[model samples]
Target: MAGSLPPLLLVGCGQMGGAMLAGWLADGLAPSVILDRHRDDIPAPHSVVRQASDLPDDFAPALIILATKPQKAAEILPSIAHFARHAPILSVMAGKTVGGLTAALAEAGTPGATVIRAMPNTPSAVGQGMTVCFAPPTATEADRALCTRLLSAVGDVAWVADEAQMDAVTAVSGSGPAYVFLLAELMEQAGIAQGLPADLARRIARRTVSGAGALMEQSGIDAAELRRRVTSPGGTTQQALEVLMAPQAWPATMEQAIAAATRRARELAS
Candidate 1:
């Protein structure tokens, strides 16, 4: 890896990519080149080109990010293969494994390209995202460190040794936000069922969930401990937990949901 990340070459500027680009800019990284067919609202100091050919002949980036959809990877990869000669490719696309990326580059005649796979959620937009990354054995320590810096710009980062674990990562954090959102939705509806006004229920549910999450983040306590702290010996919360933690209730259902998502992630990779 380079001592410092040089100018970045971002291949896509969709919602996720735009969030990261925004975080990087806010963190003072500038002089980046974005290659995308669709126009995106990007801050200044970062240039955007409609296509790879539009890039200046002399432009070389220290890092190249693959943020396009997995289905379009083959179509988008070739244009950026030139950057892989010097810069490492960091992919935020889900279900695309390291070998898959290497193969894509190989198909583009750039087998020497080093790639890292990252799974980051939408929360990255707020700089509080959880991003998990994996690098193949060929990636150098500096390469990993460079990726850590890049991911850390948006949020906390964790690394896994096994590439196969990425499927679980996808099921967990990758799709986890929607699960939380679903909880908020159900909570709001439940409040309404309990005779609360719809608008009040919605606001209360949203704030309660958000506040609990913030507390969990800052409290330096595990979720189980936090739950224990909140649930009295025989209180209403404990009563609710009895129902939610029932064998066929939330615990089992959540497990099944995550397992289904994990399977789908593997399916997409294949």
Candidate 2:
């Protein structure tokens, strides 16, 4: 299968897992198995089972994706620990450390399992995701490359040397989509307040946000430079920027928001 991914054993098929699976399927995936209780929409050649107990005896996966909820690790890891001996585990569970997952697998009879962690956002559903991964020293370069290849099917990928940075990454990119959506919401409401028709307001607000994002991606220009290019000395955009860019406005608010999100991410770590 030229240009196809290797076999995968996906342990969960919730939002994040399903998003990645969609990208993989669109890009030509090898035969794979998805272990999920409630999903039956997977096409032929890719099997879906209700539980780990139903997994085939002779199936071998090159990579095992752990996309289950972080709290479910204790119950799930032990059941799948045997696979760890043969494949590196890539976990998309938030706040679960590589050390903690490795310890869990070891306790379940699979010692020295290679574990990698990643933070990916909801945009992955649309194949525009930004995922940041952290691989511990025990994981080989091949393990890292495998993760990159699978994740790149969805969107961009990057690596961080220090696991501690993952908290900030979660704050900035993992949770960043909500912040952008909020901007669109506010913009739409403001337009309505200005007496624009509700439907027109909604369309313009959403399009403006999405169009700006596309321009940012395709132009390859710095965001600040783009902002400068749009702002004239005494134009309407400048008038709005004057208020929004106040010392205690978006600048300070965004800093505080990111710091709070980062703090919460660290607090959630197991």
TM-score of each: 0.94, 0.95
Per residue, candidate 2 scores C-alpha lDDT tens digits across 43-146 of 87999999998999788999999988877888899899999899999999878899989999999999999999999887787789999999998899999999
Error of 2 at 125 (Å): 2.5
Clashing residue pairs in candidate 1 are none
Worst 10 residues of 1 by lDDT: 1-10
Q: Highest TM-score: which candidate?
A: 2
Residue runs of model 1 more than 4 Å from their true location after superposition: 1-5
Task: Compute the lDDT of residue 193 as modeled in candidate 1.
Answer: 100
What are the root-mean-square deviations of the candidates from the true structure over C-alphas?
2.5, 1.5
